[model samples]
Target: MDSKRYIQLLKKFDGLDADTEGENTRSSVSYAILSNSETNQLQKCLGARLFEQGFQPKLIKTEFNNFATDSLDTEGELFQSDLDFVFFVLSPMGLKETIPSELNERSQFASSFLSELEMFVKNFSNKGVKVFLANIPETSERVFGNMSRIYPASFLYQIQAINAGINNLVAKSQGLYLVDLASKANYYGLSEWHDNGLWLQGKYPCHPRFFPTICDEVSAIFSSLVGKIQKCLVLDLDNTLWGGVAGDDGIDGVKIGDGIVGEAHVQFQKYVLDLKNRGVVLTIASKNYEDVAIDIIENHPRMILRKNDFAVIKANWEDKASNIQEIAAELNIGLDSLVFLDDNPFERGIVRDHLPQVCVPELPEDPTEFVDFLTQLNLFETTQFSDEDLSRSEFYYSESERKSLQKNAVDLKNYLSMLNMEACVKPIDEKSLPRSVQLSQRSNQFNLRTQRIDEMTCEKYIKEPDKFCFTVDLTDKYGALGIISCVFMSLKKDHLYIDEFIMSCRVLKRTVESLIFNEILNIAKENKAKFVVGEYIRTKKNKLVENLYQDYGFENTERSDEGSLWRIEVSGFSDLDTSIKVKRS
Candidate 1:
């Protein structure tokens, strides 16, 4: 490792410390690096770097002193005194020999740490603490080209497995994140281990010159773990001071063609467009003639985004809330998922007042700094990007067509019947867990009890005989409305308590809810449950469901300040006429 690179790395961590000091800091994360001899020195170096980065890191010294209490719970008590995240740094010796022998073949004492770790996660997660796990640097064959003492291949493989298993276990147990830092460390080699050096000194990976950059990247990943980044960017057009009326400017004159102002808007639009490509849903909300705006989007030479770029567009003379509602409806997305943007403060204010779920970005005085302003907002940062986000705009366009067709039909049954709607209700599976969790998190209007559970928790329910989760998938002539609803219930003697019930807004008037209710009833009948009980948890966005149970013939049996409980006798409940065809999984 180069000495200058080590100094640079130290400086980068110092910079992070300066940036985070006195910013309503939380309980510091106590990181424990579990490693042996050769890796011990490296862990110490990383620990030193973590201290400079505004984090406290500790290396646990494991010895065969007091086999039970001191090595397990008592020792954990000493180490986990105030720990937030535990980073396990493994080496060839640490994996094949150190851990298995030291921990004694997954003995009862080893099991103790797993339990202790679980408790830590549940306690900390409830309080909003984050955890991260980083593996040691990958030893590159190319970089270690002539080194005689190479790490044994079997040892490397075993260590990787142990690291992966521990990472997954901790993630499941602690709800913390596992970041792959090994490849990154190797890429940067041992250059400026910390930054505070010349820019060109540690920019690339080919030479041993980017260690500071690697440290910077690791610090950034940790920072991201501590915060939830905005997922979408909403855009607007017309003179809050763009040059001309989109309708009147005739595409060429409208400020976004090829000049300074146009260049600025183009740059801003391109910045947002890139965010969308990286899985942020970009939407437009402009009060303009739709045809004129569409023309400009199609014909403008400098415009990077066309009609295809926007996930949804709200271009109408209607109030911003109403327009935003349409946008949400078309996108099959929740209002909370949107970030509204417009030049007019009045429009922004109206949206802020009516639709509090949507994020409204402040307008910058200089149009030139619009892109810079967004960067400052950091409104579109995310760690994971799924494939669905890339084609979200096209999906919304298709959904609009579905909605238009849905409106033409007379009633719920009629609409469902005409479209040939099919509902597939099934026990929750791995493939549908993410969507189920999303329903719990996002479905406020039709949600009952608003219980949010991650995939692991959901998996437990599906396999539990006493509890059941049924998700609904609907497909019409238009397209598939992937896993639109979920119902989690616990079966007791003669009664079933509805723990969770939520449906997507896109399937609102399509008799999907009625079909789901009917399916649950069928299940209850088969199980010999006499009645179904439902709990309603009030939230800001779930007012639409205040009378949901009443509308569905469920009578209030219990009421309290926290939530309302309703009950319905299975025998007495009528099977309502629904046009939706049902299937079981």
Candidate 2:
């Protein structure tokens, strides 16, 4: 969107503030900004952006030019309130007062600056809050003309060192995230991003006009928390993957690799291929005969994406809306997880009207601009990524095969035994922490408490004698489902409490839950606990597990508006039935 229209939309959205307007339609998130510059405008932009994206975000205000003091003050809003995310927005302009003029002194200054910031980051992370610290904007002050690139003490070189230090800090620290302001500034162009006049007048961090870009970046990080992350990218065939319709142009006539238009299509396909490589499930929804499109994708020499790359292919004359719905059902994913890209406006409109939850980007008329458009949209944002992401498409494809087997199986136990399932249970450590925390963020329907445990807290649990954080990795005849379940527990005086239990939806009906629950009982027994307590906090998406504790022979001891609480005697509890064998690591 253009800046003018964008500003108007934000104003309208900001006016719809649920905090004051009492409109409770969207999910609400609490966030605060700690910046060394004026951040009222940044808060406004972020709040509006969240509201636009189906969230009613509450802005926690902070003192002006007091980021350092606020970071140290435990009584400040940064520490006092519960927040989904806390952003430490930074700007080079705000650091002008403290920066050293002498080239020799910059190294010392950068080290001191990072040391202080890292200490504060640790403090906040200890509070169990997710921290987002923005890397300072990259700048070329032209201190030594063309030689600035080589000079060790030049401003450009020093900024690079500082950003690198920030990168290293966030990399090692659990629950801390870098906002990548340098990359955003470079993308928007340094000159166009900052407003000198506004900075001088009110200490604005960059231009208020581009604040939405930063807000969007922040929203992407929290998207997984609310289960808003997109996992699939669905593509159209004619004019999208190639220059002409595959049905009418035939395999040889379709322009794919030899001309200007064909090269543009190839570049777009390359981008889509990159998404697939990063674990975005690719699917085809083309309004054409199956053989014609399949022939072009398989036989055409210039086709970058082969038939195997797509998890699902619906090449028929059916309306794209129906095709996309079938694709989601076949993959066992929500419609909101799908992103549709088609060159034809009519198809885009049809999908939007019928499947409003699916994200349909307006593909640019020119094929060359396709990549840039999607890049700016930031459709796929994730909090954590693991090697398991690379196999996501294959994982879903295997589900279809499993369904075929399920149709012919005699019973549940027989089906599970036929698949020959095995599970490996292990404690959360440095190696398993990434996927452990990721499952906490990603699993919604199967999450009992919906508790998102950050890495730092998980590490603390590993060290604490009374706390236990462990995960389960499942494998069957189909393939390995890496780290499909996780359980967080703490030993009380007389009982073991299950803090969080999350599992992948793909493994729901496969007796994996029974295996994990059995593990929980074993842990309680090992700890010599008298009782095992399980709690289920109600959520809109977690109705699948509303009766989780009840189903597992946990007697309900307490019930309230929030959820139900159950406990069972560890010694009296019998093992839940499961076909899978266990392996401990």
Candidate 3:
């Protein structure tokens, strides 16, 4: 989007009714910004961009330098604001005022600064607010001239040391995220980013022209943190994966390897393949004959992605929008998780108009710029990568086989039993911690309570006696569906509260949910608890599990629009029968 049009869209956000607009009442995200420089313009620009992206942003700007002390002081405004994310924007110029200017004292000053910043981050994170800490960018003006570059004890070295320290701190702290402001400034050109006039008039560090770019970066980070990451990339075969239409130009004529245009498509394919390797399901939603597309995918030597790469292939004459919806249903993923890429503007428009949730990026006029355009969008930001991610495509492929087997079975129970399913339930340990955290972060549709936590928090729960965290790994005759489910519970005085009970949608309708419920009851029994309490937190995607508690024989203790609370007496609970074999470790 152009800058002027982007600003105009932001202007429209000022009068929008925060309650009636967007998909849900919870569309609004409360964020607090603490900066050493002026941030009113930044807040307005960021809020506008966030609002445009289906989020009603309510921003609370704190006084400059308040981040250093506000988090430490219990009575400060930072503690009072109900915020989902906290942004601490820093600049070398702002730090210069507080840190000692003397070269000999700078090392001590840098250490003290990092210590205080680390404490602030820890305090805010302990309170459950996600922190976005900005790396201090090198200022345009240099006080030490060339001396700053060569000397390790110079002011520049101190800033570099502090930024490196911040990176190390964020690596260990799950709740803290680093925003690469220096890279952003470099990308926009230092001259274009720094406005002396604006800095002199108001303490604003960057020019107003660059706010849209800044907003885009920040919004991408926030989007990934909130679990809005894209899961599937639906691609068109003709003029998308290759340089020409397969039906008209034949597989040999399609440009995908040697020349300039061919290499461009090949690069695009390589990027898509990289995404596939990291858990993003690849699918074909093209308007072509299925036989021709499948032949090319299987036989083409230049193709980086093979026939087994795709989870769903809809290469028929069907409309793009209908094909995408069918693909989502077949794959058991949400429409919002699909990202459509096509060279034809008409096809893209049809999908965009019919299915608004799917992220359909506007293809550049030139095919060579496709990779660069997609890279700039940063649509696939992720918090963590695990072993399960590397094998996700295979898991989905196995699911496709399971669906075929289901169609051939005599009955639902017969189908499940024929698969020879066995579930191994075990406590969360070092090996399962990463996948367990991923499940909590990504599982939405079948999740009850929808509680998301980081690896640190998951580890903390595992060590706490009152808390119970375990994962279920399922393997059938077809393949091993690793860590397909997770259960988290808190044992209070006489009650066991189920904080999260989530299962993969692939294993739904196989009585796996009953197995998990029975396991929770058994844990409650072992803990000598009187009641097992469960909650159903309603979300845009979790409607599939709305009646989960009632289905499991838990009586509704309380009900509201937000969610419902259910409880079952330990003595009254009975184990639900399932054909699948169970193993505990």
Candidate 2 stretches greater than 4 Å from native: 18-27, 410-412
In model 2, where is the ten-residue run with the lowest total lDDT?
A: 17-26
Ranking by lDDT: 2, 3, 1
lDDT of 2 by residue, 34-144 (tens): 888898877777877777677878778886788888878988767888776788887777876678887788757677888988887777877777788899886657778
Tell me each candidate's TM-score: 0.63, 0.93, 0.92
Candidate 1's clash total is 9
lDDT of 1 by residue, 226-312 (tens): 332344556777853245678776776788747777778877777777776776767777888788778777777767888777766
The positional error of residue 568 in candidate 2, measured at the CA in angstroms, is 3.4
Worst 10 residues of 1 by lDDT: 199-208
lDDT, candidate 3, 1-585, per-residue tens: 235844664575565554356456446788877777877767777887787777888877667556667778866777777688888887666777777766677767678889988888888888888898888776666576877755656777777788889999988887888888888787667777777787777877677677677777777788777677788899999989989889998889888899998899999999999889988889999999999999888888899888799988999998999999999998898898889999999999999999999999999967799888998787777777788888888888878888888888979988888989999999999889878887888887988877777766798778998999889999899888899898888999899998888788978898998888889999999999999999999987899999989988999999999899999999988899887799999
Task: State which candidate, 2 or 3, has the greater TM-score.
Answer: 2
**Predictions in order: lDDT:** 0.61, 0.84, 0.83
**Alpha-carbon deviation at 386 in model 3, angstroms:** 2.4
| Top-scoring candidate (TM-score) | 2
